[model samples]
Target: MEEKFDLLPLLEYIPPSSLDYLEWVSVGMALKHEGYDFHDWDVWSQADSRYNAHEMESKWASLGHNGGQPVTGAFITMKAKENGWLSRQYEGDGMETFGWDDEISYERDYRFVDKAWVEGKEIQEPGDNWNPVEQLQTYIQTLFSNDDHIGYVVDSWQREDGKYSVRGSGVYTKTAEEILNDLEKYKDQKDLGWAVGDSKKEAGAWIRFNPLDGKGVKNENVTDFKFALVESDNMSLEKQNAIMRELELPIAALVYSGGKSVHAIVKVEAANYAEYQKRVEYLYKICNKNGLQVDSQNKNPSRLSRMPGVIRGEHKQFLIDTNIGKSSWEEWHEWIEDLNDDLPEFESLAGMFEEDPQLAPVLIDNVLRRGHKMLIAGPSKAGKSFALMEMSISIAEGLPWFGFNCERGKVLYINMELDRPSAYKRFKDIYQGMGIKPANIQNIHVWNMRGHSIPMDKLTPKLIRRAQKEKFDAVIIDPIYKVLTGSENDAEQMAKFTNNFDKVAAELGTSVIYCHHHSKGAQGGKSSMDRSSGSGVFARDPDAILDLIELEVTDSLRDMQGKRATANFYAEKIRDENPSYLNEIGQDDFLSAAEMRKHLAAALGDDRAWQISGFELGEVQKRVKLQTAWRLEGTLREFPKFEPVNLWFNYPLHVHDEVGVLKDLDYVGTDKPYNQRKAAVKSRDSAEKKAERKKKTTDELISAFSILDEGDGVVRIGKLESYFEKSRNTIKNWLKNQDVLMIDEEGFVSMRLELD
Candidate 1:
């Protein structure tokens, strides 16, 4: 009554009612009691109709049977479209296939060769032996016959083997000569290559590639990946051959890759390695953009026929029960059950998350602003030390961090392990990227003195005192091991260092961030502070704690060169006990409108002004606050964005307080006039130190007259002086007796223009 399929392989096509992506487990369990193994069981399913049981029920109803008898199952899916084939197709075989298709289902197994292959192997798979040779014939005839494009890009992902390997995805295209010749066009000038790669394949999709021609050595980390057949369900018009797309031909080519990680090779011979790497990463982007996901974890040992959690937990019992079902092996059932009980649970940690989630909460989850203390810990090479160095430099310079705002403050990084030059070189890369000038790089200071032999107790307070005097706002003690020598387990010793560190910070008002390492065997449920190798010392000593967990990733770049790897931050404690800052839960010092305006005006290099007028504090606040400008607490004489607000705090013109920045700033007198206030100093009327020139005029006139009356014709200009000394110019002018007209220029008081 139904239209029979006409193609030869149509009969070989497994019914959809039998096998499904989610039906394998129940089918596995159904075959559990019989055969040497579940793989011996068989069913047939069409790829499209495997998971619909409702249609099978209707079919059985038409047969005048109740629900007892199983019917071929199927699924009917349709989107909002004018499809001409307004019909449902059914396909399935065997009890599992003929049964209902719900979220839970056992697979439909069919086809003689497929059954044979499943029987031969411990596990059954749809792609195991689906007529590979026959499918190959179909593929070449249907898809490749008339194709003009000689190559195809293949992307493969495997859950095992902890390596993110890559290779030429463009399958065997032109001859090696042609490929090399094309890339050689850039030979006139050495330029970086392009980028390719799907985002799923690597962290960032850009890579480097040169000619595979007789130049670089062969890439050793090369391999082929086998994937399940669902990868090609969605194909673009550009991807499919015209012949393949037109005929509605079954194009069932598998997902395979012949790729190698050319990272090292690319690095070696690259004209510009960074550019080339970016180019290779571009390839992966195209692959994924083409609607492809090759996430196929290996399914070895087959899925547990029962609940996975149960089967693994009671593997021994399942084995014993399996053996008991064998008619001849029934007598050894007790022995098998006991043997099964002793069997260890099969665990494959190949693709499991390497870092602990519990600890992630303790790591830096949000942002880390300047003036924050954190105790970072992990094993050696776990990046504890390197991270401290990087963080110190970054915070000090106010460099961009993971796209958040950076605040610059003087970071006194004291490290015993690394040399100063080595650490400074690392800072160069980050500093340059931010477009910050070197002279403004004063925020980052790597102390040269190594603390190799200094015991924690012997570490003098003078070290931090000098740094405080130098105006460093932050201190970093890299690796707590450097200063600590005695019992790390002793809470008393740890408390001492913690107390001292806290004391120094309080006295100096500097944030002190410490670093330590994690103990071995720390895994799930380990708290960050818990991982510190010594006896809870790190926990007691710092205000914040960030854990470092290195999860094994399959990224080639991360595997080799990325030392200071993926990191996180956490704020465990906020020891805001500094009395100076206490009860003062307020924002950091920010410039008022007038202050910012004045600073910006001064910095823009305009000179010769009256009282620095026209700069409104409220108006300047409106723009910077509305626009969200950079920090400039320091270095504001240049209108710097680095620590923008800091320039206002310590600037001589402004004093910061809770009520908002008090702006009646006085000049911080210097032997030399303030360079920034040159115009103000220049415009100032000299010899005006006296209060009310009128009040002092008469006294000075009387004094001058008295002096003149007692003098020999005239008084020396240098002789008459106030309790406050007068300059020679002041004395000459005063003694000249301009008001009373009594004194002369050379300090000779001669009667000149006398008062009436």
Candidate 2:
């Protein structure tokens, strides 16, 4: 008869106590439906404290199929899944096979080896120069520390089939130190049996890979939970060695079993028994997936492995290698996962040389490309956030952003630094200020993550999943510091953090645009790429970087702007009341206050013009004073370099300088060398000192005359000396060159009058 189906292995994952009565009954019914015998169910049920020995067998027999549909093995599989049992398939000679209904889906591929590409490595036995005592001592020292209790079985009994098997659980009371000492003491005799115990030559020996507590030989008695055994007898020995090396399993010791299999003690380094079980399961799953057929029965912590330096009938079970793979379990696991990442495969450049490969479409005309990244960096209150919001609107409405045309498509604005209401109002304000209608308002999506923002590493996947179906052309993140994951100055950490943006852009097929702040200093002298406040990776990683630097608006420019604004205010008032008056005024006349007043008199009559002349025009002057000038420099990867664009931040919007008003303005420090800047500052200070001294002398003389004058508009020189803090002669000489004052030899001072 065919072997009874084994449900016991899967039952290890599903504890009976975790199940309710109905779920428990379902398990038994499914077991019966799958043709498993009653004994299997009874044995597994006994693990729960509620199990009644007498009722279990009767309950199992009564789980026969009724008139309704019978529960199949899928129920058992589902319960296993709920309890962390992954559904995996193994393909090799003599490995357990899954039925047609097994739901096989691996969350990630852990396979690091290919069977067809494996180059088998042959194992060579030691010649007449072999030392059994040294081999045994090395194996023991590599696996255990001095304080760890060692378990090894040497004695065995012959089975009825003439094959030898281990007789007992072996000795668990000896420490590794004692075993090594004994081996060294008996080295001169060359007798391995005297150090531990004599073993049957036919069975070789067995030793537990993990250290025990010196009190028992069960899984619970294991202390360190360190190593696990990986052995396979169904495949060629040479192939197993090659696959094990290819997978880079962290092996503490590797021993040939004198038979078809090789025993590899793999370092799991789990903290507890529970963690040990999980790690071993993961190790086995990875091994099986990679074409190394590991024996599933060797998973227990107390399971015995082949003891090296021992004889088994006509062959020797000898140590092959130690510390042969990765240094630690964590390092090895990371290497495997990185090797199997879901990155795209490589293609030969020669294959596409004959034809031009298509590039990602342009998202921001002449600045950035679709499915790429762009960074906008500037100082605080430079309207960086406003610029990003305007870009979003521009993309949605098919308009221009900072003089660059944008492709019209769906866009997502992730607001990480604003409250929900403020964010909504800002979008509306931008729309009104830009004078763009809401023709494609539906294309603009606002995800107000404000208070709920998380790190970029954790948020990127969620962003991808949500925006995958939106078919967006761009994703704009305002102020990246809210979700930045690591120190901005650390290149390694920032690289990992910024890679999340790449993931989002690649997964969603959208351009990712974000804003950052400039480094704390004058940004005039630094390159555009070096001005962002972070590691240089931030400057180099993106496809395009746009930097904003403040420009020094000269006093003359401000005065010019005030006059032009005042004239425009008058022109607008006349245009509103008398439309024909604009035709009478020339274009240059609108830029002059006198010309605008003459036009206003003709347009609205003298009474209205007089009323308009008295108007304060304070609001217009305030608008001019509040205006901030900036120069935008670009470092683009996909396009040719363009001239720097100048802008004016006029409250709610950044308006491009169309008439080159800001073209002559320079950044705060200019681009001069440090020494040159210092010299210019010194020269400016010297000139200012001369003008200030002349003004001070004139004020003192005028004040002294006013205080000493007795309605005659003249003051005595002796009284002026008290204010001058100098001699009378010095006071007289100081007034000799004054154009506004006349001093006589009699020591009296009077005002100087013009001859005209």
Give per-model TM-scores: 0.25, 0.60
Model 1 scores worst on lDDT over the 10 consecutive residues at 564-573
lDDT of 1 at 678: 55
* Per-residue lDDT of model 1, residues 1-756, tens digit only: 945322222212222232334333333232232222422323322233233444433432233133443323221211000111112234453112111122221111111111112211121122322332232223223222232222222233433433332334433333333333433443333211211112232311211122222222223211111111112222231232221222121222322121211011001112343433343332212222222211111111111011000111112101100111112212222433344353467755764466443321111223332334567665655444545655665566565432334466677777777777766665675445434566656667777656344765555454643554565666788766778856778887777767667655655566667777667673323534576787775665555555544332224422221211110000001122122322232222121333323333333334421223245423433333322101111111112233112112111011112232212222222232223355555456443444357557757666565654554455554455542277876656654434553554455554454458
Scored by lDDT, the top model is 2
lDDT of each: 0.36, 0.84
Clash pairs, model 2 backbone? 201-313
In candidate 2, stretches whose alpha carbon ends up further than 4 angstroms from where it belongs are 1-108, 111-170, 173-207, 210-227, 230-285, 288-301, 304-349, 574-581, 605-617, 669-756
| lDDT (tens digit, per residue) of candidate 2 on 1-756 | 966545667787666754567778888998888888888787888766567787787778677645678888888876665444556445675333453255223246565577778989999988767888988899988999998999989988886556788887889999999999999999986668999988888789888988889999999889999999988654689999888888889999999999888899999999998999999988877776776656666888999999888888778899999999999999998988888888778988888798898999988899999999999999999999899889899989989989999888889999999999999999899899988788999999999998898998878866865675678899999889999988999999999999888888877789999999999978876778889998999889999999998889989988888888888888988988999868888888988977897888888999988876664577778988999999899999999988889998987899999989988787876766434666887899999997787777878888888888889888888888887779987887668646678888787889988897
